[model samples]
Each structure stands twice: as C-alpha cells, then as structure tokens.
Target: MLLEIDAQSQTPIYQQICNQLIIGIATNKLQPGEILPSVRQMADEIGVNMMTVSKAYTLLKNDGYILTDRRNGTMVAAKQSLDPPFQARFSRELELLLAEASIHQISETMIQEKIKQIYQKFE
Candidate 1:
C-alpha cells in the first residue's frame, strides 16, 4: 500500500493515513483479511512517528474498517453493512459536505454528479 503525506496540508498526518486507507478499502486495493503493516513498520516505511500510524489504525479499528488479534496483528475487516451509528455519522458528514459545497456556490447538479462519480469508484 502507498500513502502520500503532505507536510504542508491542513489535515494531520494521522488523518491523511486514515483517509487513504479507507479509500483503499473502499476501492478494493485493500481487501478483507489482508494484512496491514504494523504501526512500527508503516512508520518506518512512510517516515512518520509510530504513534501517528497507531492513531490512524486505532481510528480505523473504532470505525470497523480493521481487525486486530494476537495471531493476525492487523488486517482489513469484512463489514457486511453499515450499522446504525455509522450510518448516522456518515449522514451527518455528508450533510456537512453538501452544506460546504452550497456555501461555495457549487450547483446541486454538480454536487450530484460528483457524488455519482464517487459512488462509481466504490462499485
């Protein structure tokens, strides 16, 4: 897996890692049961603090994107569907995004088309 981090960006390194990994899972670049690099290994590979990678992995774990066990270390999780809390969180985030787009004067049609394009990526 490849992760690109921009030191100058507004987003934190941990969040950048989380975003990319989530994208990878959604796009099937990372598959269920596939092993992920350990926090130390990922830190060494990407030249970041181990804690940062650990935080990203922790967030993914909390969000149900990954699994951890003594035998497996860390791996992608096979989520059958979104649970209630997750669905609510996603709805709120999407609502905020749409609000921000409207604030920027992005048209409804454009927002919908962009949404469609993103949905297609998951498919």
Candidate 2:
C-alpha cells in the first residue's frame, strides 16, 4: 500500500493516516484480507512515533474497517452491507447534500449529467 503524508497539514498525523488507509481500501488499492504493515514498522518508515500509527490502527479496528488477530496481525475487513446506523448516517448526509443542491437550484438530472461528464473524463 502506498501512503503520502503532509507533515505541514493542519490535520492530525493519525487522522491523515487513517483517512488515507480508508480511501485506499475504498478504491480497491488495498484489497480485503490484505495484511497491513505493523505499527512499529509503519511508524519507523513514516518517521512518526509508534503511538501515532497505533492510534490510527486502533481507530480503524474500532470503525470495523480492519480486523486484528494475534496471529494474523492486521488486515482489511470484508465489505459488508451498511448497518442501520450507517444507513441512517448516509441518509442524513444525503439530506444535507440535497439541501445544498436546492440552495443552488440543482436538480437530480443536473447531478447525473455532471457525474457522467466527470466519469467520462476520468475514463
């Protein structure tokens, strides 16, 4: 897995690590069941304290993005359908998005068109 850290950013080091790892997983750059580097190894490679990497790993495990076992170390968790709390949180985020879209008089069609245009460009 590849990670880039901006030491100058306002975000905390641990949060940056966590966010990058989450994005990597979501993008399929880091596959499910793939083992992650150990905290001490990552900390040494990233030139950060072991506590920082440990914090990020703990947060990821707590959030169900990773699984940890004494023998297996840490690996990405299998993707599961969203639970009730996750579904509710997603709905809340969508509601906020719709509200913002309405503020600009944006319609569903406009959103779809923009998405298609961006998708084609990426392709």
Candidate 3:
C-alpha cells in the first residue's frame, strides 16, 4: 500500500498512516492477511521516525485492523462486523454531519452526492 504523508497537515504523521491504511483496507488495496512493510522499512520509505511508524502500527493493532506476529510480521486482519455500540456511534456521527449540512442549506441531493464522492475514494 502506498501511504502518502502530509508533514504540514494538522493531523499527526502516525494518524495519517493509520488513516491511509484503513482506507487501503476499505478499498481492497491492502488485502486481508497481506503482510505490511516492516516498521524500519516503512519509516525509511516515508521519511518518518521509526517511532512514528511503530505508533501507527500499534494503533492499527489495538483497533483490530492489523495483527502482528513474531514469525509472520504484520498482516491485515479480517474485517469484523460492527456491533451495536459501534453502529450507534456511526449513526450519531452521520446525524451530526447531516445536521451541519442542513444548517448550511445543503440540499439532500447535494449532500448525497458529496457522500458518494467521498465513498468513491475508498474504491
């Protein structure tokens, strides 16, 4: 997976790495059980500190997006079905977004179109 880092962005480098990896998984760019680059290698490639890459990997592992093993290294985990609490949180976030769009006078069609555009990025 090709991860692009924006050093100047407000988001931290580790978070950017995690976000991109998540997108890669969502878009099928990174297949389940595929091995990711080693932390040292990824850090060298991305021009970031090893600790930054390690932090990203740790976050992914903690979130169950990736798994690390001594023999196998790191690989993407199978996608898990969202449970009730997660579904509720997703719904709440979506409602907030829709509410903000409505306050801005964005039409339903326009909002849907925007969502489609964002979703297409994952594909």
Candidate 4:
C-alpha cells in the first residue's frame, strides 16, 4: 500500500488515512484478502501516532470494509451488496445533490454527462 499524508491539510490524519484506504479498496489499488500493514508500522511510515492508524483501521473494520484476524491481521473483505440503510443514504444524497444543482441552474443531464466524463477518465 502506498499512503501519502499531508500534515498541512485541514482534514484530520485519521480521516485522511480512512478516506485513502477506502478509495484504494474501491479502485482496486488494494486487493480484497490482502493484508494491510500493521498499525504500528503504518504509524512509523507516516510519522503519525499509532493510535491514529488504529482509529482509522477500527473505522474501516466497523464499516465492514476490512476484516482483522489475530493470525492474518487486516485484509479487505468482499464487497457487499448495498443494504437498505445504504440504499436510503444514496437516495437522500442524490435528492440533496439534485436540489443543490437546481438551485445553481444545473440540469440533470448536465450533471450526468459530467459524471460520465469523470468516470470515463477513471476507466
């Protein structure tokens, strides 16, 4: 895993770690069933406190994004189908986003086309 931390960023260290790891998993930069570095080792590499890395790892585990075993350590878990709560969250986010876009005079087609362009770049 390659993690770069910006100590000057406004985001908290643990949050940066959490967000990057999540993106790594979603983008397949980090593979499922791959063991993550130990929290102490990560802390040493990032020059942050061990507790910060531990907190990020804990958050990932709680979110069902990773599994931690005594022998195998932490590995990415299989991606799960969206649960009802997550589906509701997605709907709420889309509604809020559309409302904001309307206020800004942006149409649905404009938003969707922009998203497609961004997704294409990723691909």
Candidate 5:
C-alpha cells in the first residue's frame, strides 16, 4: 500500500492513513483478504510513529473497513455495513459537506457531476 501523507494538511496523520485505506477499498485498489503491513513496518515505510499506524488500523477495524488476525495478519474487510445508525451518520456528514460547498457557491450541477464520477468508481 502506497499511502501519501501531507504533513501540512489540517488533517491529522492517522486520519490521512484511515482516509487512504478507505479510498483504496472504495477504488478496488485494495481487495478483501489482501494483507496489510504490520504496524512497525507501516510506520517505517511512512516515516510515522508506530502508534500512529496502530491508531489508524484500530479505527479502520472499528469502522469495518479492515480486519486483523494473528495468523494471517491484517487485511481488508469483505464488506462494509450500511446499518440504519450508520446511514444516519453518513447522511449527516454528507449534508454538512454539501452545505459547505453551497456556502462556497459550488453549483449543484458540478457537485452532481463529481458525485457521479466518484460513485462510478465503486461500480
């Protein structure tokens, strides 16, 4: 996995890792059963602290985006759930995003086009 981190970005290091892994899963760049690097190895590879990588992995596991087994190591999850509680949270986040875009005067057509382009990637 090649995860790019922007130290200057407002997002924290762990979140950048989490976001990239999620994107990898969404884009089919990472498949179910694909093993990921160990915390120490990933830390060295990305020049981040081991704890940072561990935090990211833990969050991903909790979010159902990845799994870890002692024998096989960490790997992507087979599927992500869309439970009702999670759906509500997802909707709220998306609504906030749209509101921000609207505040910036982003046209609805542009947002729809971008949404379609991104949604097609998961197909």
Candidate 6:
C-alpha cells in the first residue's frame, strides 16, 4: 500500500486517498482480507489529518471496498457481483472516455489497443 497525496490537487485529499486505494484493489496490489493501516498510522504516513484518512476509509467501507471490525481492524472486502446501477455507471463513464478519445483524434484501433493493454494489466 504505497499511497501518495498531492497537496496541490483540486480534488479533496480523502477522495484522492479513496481513489488510490480503489486502484490498488482493482489491480490486485491489495488482496482481499489484507489489513490496511490504522487511520492515525495512515495520516502520519501520508502527512494528512487523521480525519482525512478516516473519511477515505469510511467511503471505502460504505462502497463495500473494505471492511472494518472492532477486533480485526480494517481489511479489503471480498469482491462482490456488480449491481445494475454500478454497471450502468461504468457504461456511462466508458462512453465519456471513448468520446474524449475520439475528440482528441485517437483512432478506434488505437483506443481498442489501449483498452486491451489496460485490461491485460488486471489479469
């Protein structure tokens, strides 16, 4: 779990932290049941306030990306089946990205190749 925070970014610190953790889980860099650092520990490590880390953790937990237990602390949750709403959101986002690529004059073949490369990384 190497988490980096950009103090100057327009995004909120907690959102950035949540995004990175989500990426880690998606890439399998953080496995299911892997324990995450305590909120205070993560705050100290990232040089952010404990509240920021807690907010990120809270978001992750709410999204079913992580779990918290009184005795076991926090760990990655097992992957769940994607619900219809999640699938719809994913489709919309992919459409927006493809539209942007098209606007930038990225060829269809190139866009497909990039998608393939990224998809392969998850494997």
lDDT of 6 by residue, 1-123 (tens): 879899999999999999999889889999999999999999999999999999999989998999999899999999879799789989999999989998999999998898899888777
Candidate 5's C-alpha runs over 4 A off are none
For candidate 3, the per-residue lDDT at 96 reads 99
lDDT of 5 by residue, 24-117 (tens): 9988899998999999999999999999999999999998899999999999998766799789989999999999999999999999999999
- Candidate 2 lDDT over 1-123, as tens digits, reads 757889999999999999999878876788899999999888988889999999999999988999999899999998767799878987999789989998999998998898687556423
- What does candidate 3 score on TM? 0.85
Candidate 5: the clashing residue pairs are none
Each prediction's RMSD over C-alphas, in Å, is: 1.0, 3.5, 2.0, 2.4, 1.0, 1.4
The better candidate by TM-score, 1 or 3, is 1
The lDDT of model 3 is 0.93
Estimate the TM-score of every prediction.
0.95, 0.75, 0.85, 0.81, 0.95, 0.90
Residues 1-123, candidate 1, lDDT per residue (tens digit)? 889999899999999999999999999999999999999999999999999999999999998899988787999999558589888988999899989998999999998898899999999
Give the distance in Å from residue 78's predicted Cα in candidate 6 to where it truly belongs.
Answer: 0.9
lDDT (Cα atoms) of all candidates against the true structure = 0.93, 0.88, 0.93, 0.90, 0.94, 0.93
* Clash count, candidate 5: 0
Q: What TM value does model 6 have? A: 0.90
Residue range 1-123, candidate 4, lDDT tens digits? 778999999999999999999878877788889889999989999899999999999999998999999999988988878899879988999899999999999987999999898666434
Model 1's number of clashes is 0
Using lDDT as the yardstick, the better of models 1 and 5 is 5
